[model samples]
Each structure stands twice: as structure tokens, then as C-alpha cells.
Target: MKRFFTALALIPSAAFAHVGDHSHVAATHLLTEPDHLGVIGVVIVIALGAWLWRRGRS
Candidate 1:
């Protein structure tokens, strides 16, 4: 579980690579870039699924 969260924590690093280039419009860049958008989308889906699974378990 610790390793899972560690991996998730680092997943956003890919999106940060362009931070300096789009400081003024990072939000826009994140929305427009397919790679970045996909990363965020996948993360959100995974997190939501995990939450639902854990809730069901309890």
C-alpha cells in the first residue's frame, strides 16, 4: 500500500515537466495537452475506483 501511494505520488511528475514553460497558463496547458490530460484522467479514475472499492470493503 505504501509503495502504491508512492508510485501515485510520482505519477504527476510527468505533468510538471512543462511547468516552467507554462507558468502563466499551466491550467490551460494541462487541459490542452493530451498526454498530460490523459495522465490526470487515469489518476482520477484509479483513485475513484480505489475509494469505491475500499468503501465497499468496509
Candidate 2:
């Protein structure tokens, strides 16, 4: 069970490299559109909050 959790945790880092291409392209599309920046800001805030919440729990 411990090893299973360990592998599961490592899988994200390995998998993340392939996932960002689409988002990167989308970000480029929004580069000239200031209106969408707010959405990006919200996502950043949520991500930071989740990261901090997990760290605090740990």
C-alpha cells in the first residue's frame, strides 16, 4: 500500500510534461486578450490555495 501511494504520487510529475502543451497553446491565444487574464488569475489563486492547504495539512 505504501509503495502504491509512492508510485501514484510520482506519476503526476512524469505525466505533467505531456499535459501542458495544450494549455501553453491556449495561453498564447489569450495573450492579446486582456479579458481572459482574470480567468488565469483565478486559476492561479485556486492552485496556490490548494497547494498551501495541502502543505498545511501535512
Give per-residue CA lDDT, model 2, range 37-57, as digits (tens).
655565567568767877999
Candidate 1 lands at a TM-score of 0.64
Top candidate on lDDT is 1
For each candidate, what TM-score against the reference? 0.64, 0.47
Mind sharing the TM-score for model 2?
Answer: 0.47
Q: Candidate 1's residue-wise lDDT over 1-58, tens digit each?
A: 5877888877765666454566567577778887788777888898899889889999
